[model samples]
Target: MERSTGVQAYYAESAERLGEVYESVSFEDVHGALLDLLPEAPARVLDVGAGTGRDATALAGRGYTVDAVEPVAELRRVAERLHPGSGVTWRPGALPEIPGVRGPYDVVLLSAVWMHLPPEERPGAMRRLAGLLAPGGLLLITLRRGEPPVDRRMFDIPPEEVADQGAAAGLRLLRTVAEGADRLGRDAVRWHAVVLQLG
Candidate 1:
């Protein structure tokens, strides 16, 4: 986690700013690509790397049981305050090794957070996430593809490669949405969503 300092710092400092931006957007705007694939309301959802609890809280509001994992205390604090008593359980955890969170979830969402993992950890992270899915569960991942901010750290994660990782993890790809610009209209950014099922 030595290399994670920059990422941790970025989120810690910009949580408020990011929360404001996220507040102005709907969960559908961020995850509409998998609208049809998501399990019914009241299903168990694990929102890994859930920042500011926006998506998790929204899903909870719609009747889903959500566990939102965010390792950054700065963001977690703000998220807790922002969505107080929203029925979302926020945990302190990170990828490749998210601790203290039980799984077997109907839907496992990793939105816009996949690119943060170093390239070498993708396989293990995918495997770990796959292990958490219930039978026929959907693993929804959004990969950001493009150059990172000059100050922030990110990789141009390849969609095809992520698909391969899913296959390697014994998951089957269900649907792949077309690429789109960042929800915040960041020109240098593009995102692709892939829904994979654990049979």
Candidate 2:
């Protein structure tokens, strides 16, 4: 929960709009590259920045136990309302220091949320993410690349940088989908999925 105040406010005020926009894309479509890498059902999964519970709900439907962490209150409300009885627990939290969450999850997912962490915080954040994983657990991180929006804070983090940081945190690089077209059809935006594993 160490993100800046402005980012928090932005998500809070835009939660409704964001919920609609985020849910427009199906989980399979958004995460197809790494879908096969997900652990089987009954495994514990943590979805950070789980806006509107799109992925969390979908994962729950697949029979996995999911804990969804969202920083904005409005988004959590929207998520619960949109997917009632989804079997996914929703909580307020942020990166580098996720509070109130019991970890050692089989899978940890961060979709389109890592860019907000300032460069200096990435190493620490990577370590924290690593610590949250169980032995041989998977850490799936989706990076949004290209120019950032004018209104919100973002960084164009390279995949190599993340891989290096993960390695420094004792994670082994497992897979890297170099780039994919933006599902939202934004020409300026692309995505990269980096999967790491703890020994």
> TM per model?
0.95, 0.97
lDDT of 1 at 69: 92
Residue range 114-173, candidate 1, lDDT tens digits: 888888888998999999999999999888877777787787777788889999999998
CA-RMSD of model 2 = 1.1
Residue-level lDDT of model 2, residues 94-178, one tens digit each, is: 8878877888899999998888899888898899899899999999999999999877788898888889999999999999996
Mind sharing the TM-score for model 2?
Answer: 0.97
* TM match of model 1 to true structure: 0.95
Off by over 4 Å in 2: none
Report the CA-based lDDT of candidate 2 relative to the real structure.
0.90
lDDT of 2 at 167: 98
In angstroms, the error of model 2 at 19 is: 1.2
Q: What is the lDDT of residue 21 in candidate 1?
A: 85
